[model samples]
Target: MTGESGTTRLPRQRDTTPTAQVRLLVAVGTDKHPFDRLVDWLAQWHAQAADPVRLTVQHGHTPAPGVPGGVPFLGHDALQQAMADADLVVCHGGPATILEARRHGHLPIVVPRDPARGEHVDDHQQLFARRLGAAGLVALCETREALHHALATGLADLSRYAVAADPHAHEARRAAVDRVGQIVEELVDRATRRPPRWRAWARPDRGAKETR
Candidate 1:
């Protein structure tokens, strides 16, 4: 498939729809606060979404009571499975989640967690968001306001979020991987270092005792 830029796109894997109960899947949070606020936000967005009903926000973390829209949270395996069935994915900025969502061909909307705001342990998530968004595989929402808008409207085209896996950035990722592989193999092939004691004769007796 060719996109607007005339770049040939990779063949897309077809998504399998399950019982059709869910159309959107959300995998929020990091090592931080467990996506509670994100869940609350989604609930509000869902309440205003119309029928055909827009989407079912399959969450990855539990929401406190009276959160009107989203329901029970799914396990890791379950959420990935749900993404495979989903038409779209909403998530925090995590590479693993972005990879899975792309593998399943679900357009992803990523919201970066701000550590300055106490959203995560650090700012790596912001980096993740920037890279993926720049690549074209996912749409990045830098704030709760942006996230709500992204979800309410549906998956944003942001193909610019992922590079064409067939080529474009292929050489870059592969070269990096190959370099690491070589380094690892070189390390593995190195001779083991012996302790100073081992360098000494295993048996002082191995050497014929110098006749006094």
Candidate 2:
């Protein structure tokens, strides 16, 4: 099938066929906004690669350049299946997406969205990616040069990037959950407090009715 950009989707072989190549899955998430910068980089990377690389992309709401066999989107189940079958996973810096990639036993190469560039609602993805990168959980890249370097050196040995079980991982998750719970409780309590309906009208001169 042809994508909106006139890119043709690749056909899948029968279930019995043997796979021989390293597969790469690039997920741009399901956000309504476009992330064409990442999509464009993928296209360029595919074009300039010295070796043939198997590439498939989930180009959500973005205008990706035509690839030989690319899909615009994939269902959740299909996405998960692709990640499991992939030798390397590339994605935006979303906490959930990163965790999902890890769940499939691959450390993802992450390019965080910049809110200043209209890639996300805020810079939380950048923040999270930095933290994860510092902790050796994921490879983080903010520029084309860094991305190319990562793919060259890091892709060949994905095992080295795998996030190992450690005290820091457990502590971070536990602390986040507890902090969020406390914030939620505070919001609910504030919302439940009733305010007097006639409080504004209580003042005679300030938005009050004049005596006729």
Candidate 3:
């Protein structure tokens, strides 16, 4: 069904059909860069997977996946509703998206954009994804093989990817905001604190006399 702003609403009905068990919501965010690689991987998986899976893609700048449920963007409420209805949440390495999924009781499967592949401006996504992965906050899939494995695993046991929704969601959101801020600050400090070439060049010999 069409939602506000012409966005397609994700199907909320529980289909009793045998193939309707697994519902995936994939959001690649609304970044300027096109994340064609992730969309391509989803298409490849959907085409080849043995089971019938319901896949809804919020593709953003990426080219349409040519699938039935391909929405370019979702409004705030629509996204939240979609996430609530999804059995599995697959998304980019965006921190906000990751946290939002978690708030909805999903341990999201994340694929960080690659700067080497022109998916993003730099490797910050990769860096942040790794950090969160290390903390066991997300399932970080950096390769097609890994993503495939994650999809297969999540489909097999949906409960494995599910988390307990925080009772205090508002407090959780505040904490998430603070956590993201810390991570960004750390990343910025790491990037900016590197000794610059100018610093080395401007350093004068300790024994040298003062300039006239």
Candidate 4:
């Protein structure tokens, strides 16, 4: 859009399909670290309740909760396909997983790994999940109660997190790409044109050849 001051703005667009169309996919991650807390919580839920949603779980490094048909891990391709078919995704707070869920049109219900509980090396997962939650990108659940509540309520209205295509956002992305390209070009030029700092350290016997 052209602004009053003659500045052009990128148009933003969003389109959403109703949530009633997909199944459910759950994953923690393939990290070596076990997320038994999440796994156990899920297994307990599965065992106790008659969940109507068709659920497929990728338990990852954690021991299977012994859920009758549990899968230890779905390789990348299988996971992607599962996400594509899912209306809701229950997952750990890894940023890549969250983004992948969103790409598949599900606003993931995320339980971030807590390092205090030895779920991760640090609290980055919790921190990142909070940030995304604040942006209305993912539903954040810190405890089993919260996770259960989110799943119960969220599955019914998956459209709530459906991303709408916005032209403004698209334009901003293009602008960001252009800016990054410019910065990369500048860095490459500088690296190529700048004199080698090791020039002074060159062997005199070698005619002071510049070191790479």
- TM-score of each candidate? 0.57, 0.67, 0.83, 0.65
Model 1 stretches with alpha carbons more than 4 Å out:
1-22, 29-32, 52-62, 65-73, 155-212
lDDT string for model 2 (1-212, tens) is: 45333444343221222444557788989888788888888778778776666788888888765776467788888987887677778899876678767756667899988888899876667766877789888889899887777776644555554443221244555565566456445544564567655543576665655332
Q: What does the lDDT come to for candidate 3?
A: 0.83
Root-mean-square deviation of candidate 3:
7.6
In terms of TM-score, the best-performing candidate is 3
For model 2, the superposed segments whose C-alpha errors exceed 4 Å read 1-19, 161-212
lDDT of 1 by residue, 77-180 (tens): 76756765566677777666666666556557888667766666666667656765786657888766887777656533323233333334444445655654
Kindly indicate the candidate among 2 and 4 with the higher lDDT. Answer: 2
Model 1, residue 11: what's the lDDT? 43
Better structure of 1 and 3 per lDDT: 3
lDDT of 4 at 162: 54
Ranking by TM-score: 3, 2, 4, 1
Window of ten residues with lowest summed lDDT in model 2: 9-18
For model 4 the TM-score comes to 0.65
